[model samples]
Target chain A: MEFEIEKIAQLSRLSLKPEELKKLRKDIESILGYIKTLGDLKTGDIEPTSHVLDLENVFRKDDVTRINIRDEVISRAPCVEGPFFKVPKVVDKE
Target chain B: MEKQLYELTLKEAIDVAKAEGPWEIIRAVIDRTALLNPRLNAFVRFEPEHFLKKSRKSEDFKGVLSGAPLSVKDNICIHGCETTCASKILRGHVPPYDATVIRKLGDAGAFFLGQCNMDEFAFGSSCETSAYGAVKNPWDIERVPGGSSGGSAVAVAADMTIAALGSDTGGSIRQPAALCGVVGLKPTYGRVSRYGLIAFGSSFDQIGPITKTVEDSAILMNLISGFDPHDSTSVNQTVPDYTKALARNVKGLRIGLPKEYFVEGIDPEVETKVREAANVLKQLGAQIKTISLPHTAYAVAVYYIVAVAEASSNLGRFDGVQYGLRAPGKNLLEMYFETRNQGFGEEAKRRILLGNFVLSAGYYEAYYRKGQKVRTLIRKDFEEAFKEVDLILTPTSPTPAFKINEKISDPLAMYLSDIFTIPANLVGIPAMSLPCGFTEKGLPIGVQLMAKPFDEEGIFRAAFALEQEIRIYKRKPKL
Candidate 1:
């Protein structure tokens, strides 16, 4: 029925101040308590629904065509100037 | 002529607006919106000038919807227009390109009336979670129209627009349609292109129509059904003329009433409406038979695990570094945390957390994998049932629309709103909600029709027939 800011922030990959965490704990619990109904069902023989109807292996050819938007795509990339894909440092080697 | 468009199907109303100028009709919608939207909260934004100009020259212009007013749920991207998805995170974020559906609708001559409100990021069942504000029902201003497509449904119900398009994942389209007393069809998974729709659950997400009648919905669906290479998941199939298939003849076709669907917990009124719809099918010469979909009970549970798991991964892209608004902070990690912490609403954060836990290294097998396996069993249940019948029947939700504040405080209550409708999304089949009946309090009840994958024709034929037989088709929302 209750949650801690530290635990939820870790689960959600978010960071918050002590006060913010205190607020988040109540909010997360309020939301989690609401989502918890799925746990009460006797899902035993019942199959869970992943896709409404079944769609299996819809295939497409592996043929490669022109990188159609070569110019437009490269031109629009945010912080890029030349023919390279530039991205902010996302991960650091531990 | 200005009385109400809610009383007419989109086709008839469009024809009338075409023969006559759309000025009168559009004005009437605007007027009603003024009187009604104060309580309904159906629209997130409006551009009366653009809509009027298009309607005046409707005949001179060309497209299937020619000046037929339509609202887009906040998520569907429109070039130079906001696609907020009722979330503050995307507040003021406008897409540079039109979602494929937006382009199609625009090309087809449909008037884009502006965005409709919804649950934040399309994450909640009731419209209450929206950052803008919760949308109240047209039928009863205090009650919700159901969501995440609540505003779209409310617009159609309140006559703010003739028809609207909404995205459905786990009954977002159909549940709201049921609550608002309209028709909503979530086509087979790949039936409509998902090119520019904001994702919640990519595998289950689909754009569907919310309209006054089955035939009108068919016309709209036909225009949007063809494959778009832009969306890798869009199916390339021959787009059938759905309207032509509605000949009021579904005689001798097998109709399956899954016992699991009719079990306890469904409100008595909802059960009555669904049962009465079954009787109508029988009278029309279809053989009604009871069938067992043993896995029905697990639908909501499995849906949450898999949907949240996908949601967590899908939502990961919303980090501060990528796009949209961000809170300035020292260091990259602070930037990411601050942006997301301030950006996402309560429900979205909860899902991301739950998704993280379920999809984490240790618990992935028990929650995500097991949910998938159970999903397969549910699919098999539908498969076995389909062999014995052409269609399955059930109530769209456990009850008619609940009050706005009633379930918004409890996320579990909101998820349960999807219990009756999620099974079809899980199996990837076409399902629709047809206005079946109303409760004593005058709220709408929706009867659902589900058919096998790629067999949308059966669904259309059934809903079209039911629309004709259901006496409530002529009734308009009291708003």
Candidate 2:
């Protein structure tokens, strides 16, 4: 059971050291190997349960009741410029 | 006098507070936290001022939990207080608003004791994954208090707090309660609102109580379990006064012992004690019968897939641009890489990667989808078994609390410890761990009682019956 370890880590937004990647590679392989046994069970026609309570499409009144703590929320951000959260540039400047 | 105060259960403590005033109870809890926290490492940060101020103003208050100093697991948000899920990624993230549970606790007049320690992001079965350091079991400082609720359980067991709240994804509350010798209840999923709980496995996580007795757990449950407009998944069922369910005779109750739970890996002492607990329940008028939850064998495998899949998606909120720790890097991608690399611990990284792998393009159908299908079978197993039994009894853990680093390097072995407890979370039912007996080394063992969804009363009635007969509450760790 082999995998593209670096690819998965990149997708996960994690940067692993070389040694850490080596260890994770082994762990993932073993865990995936164990999970393979689940294929033996006959789950034909059985629906998957995503949420236990089976709640669906709940809607509430959309009245814009005043925002109570706009300042407090922005104040807790790691980096904020004025009233908005500051972030790195999403697009590279040409 | 301090020793006597420390020994008081939540109900007993409430009575004392009523007679002498709330300040007396607050001072006793603070004194105990000061003396025991350094050695036990049960708390990451304590807001003594918050508790003190609350107690001072609570002079005229006479609510259900008034004067009780309750510690909370770090994952639950408190306004203006840091709510790091014991992860470096969330080093200084303070929530602007209070979690629904915090608001309810406040309304009930329970004082905020402090932020207790836990596994980072509630990742590990043992509490060793916390960035703050492992919480040592009060019974034996060398052993781990079972976690991610380790600190919460330790605080209650060591008398540092009257009661504490912990989140259960898979046995976080009960396993630690078992290891530390206390009562831990995981209310049915959606029975307690999860609006502010830091999501581990969103479908599996529920915040519940770790306390000194079943009645105290019932009292806390009444306060915490209710429908919240803030949480969509919160059920609309009417919440019962759980204390009223206690002490009802179990004479006609039907108890099922799933053969799958009493398998080879279980410690002999744990098996004997749990079996003996069954016999005691039988003598009290309950009939014991062997039952089969055939799908039990697949629980752990299915849990990891579903939990890690949800966790991967849930943990994505922690990238560099948000409230947690940020790392300096040349570009946006590098910043996300470096920040998460530095912020998350080894176990957190492992799960994130595993989660992404299973949910990734090619593997999604086989791993994540099939795992969900298998989960249905596991839930169906419980649905079928409940027809023949009123409750299911099993060992909370296969063995007692092990030494701190025993299974840290072995993830599979560590995952196996939660085998019995995980099924309850998967099936969305109420279950609890009660101190049943002890090991030769004097470590406490717990027996698990599980009932159908919303039937927490069944669990309490049987646990209270056995607890009355065994008198396990009289014993305490020498700590």
Alpha carbon lDDT of each predicted model: 0.80, 0.90
Clashes of 2: 1
lDDT of 1 by residue, A1-94 (tens): 3344466567676776676566546655654444454455445665444554345766777888864545543443333447654444556668
Candidate 2 wrong stretches, greater than 4 Å = B1-3, B53-56
Q: In candidate 2, what are the lDDT values of residues B22-108, reduced to their tens digit?
A: 677778888989988999999999887965654448543468876677889999998888899999999989888889998898788
By summed lDDT, the worst window of 10 consecutive residues in model 1 chain B runs over: B52-61
Error of 1 at B434 (Å): 1.0
lDDT of 2 at B395: 98
Docking class of 1: acceptable
Give the alpha carbon lDDT tens digit for every residue of B326-406 in model 1.
676655676668778888887888778777767777667667767787788778888899899999988999999897688
DockQ metric for all predictions: 0.28, 0.76
Off by over 4 Å in 1: A1-8, A16-94, B1-7, B50-60
**Which residue pairs in candidate 2 collide?**
B251-B285
TM-score of chain B of 1: 0.96
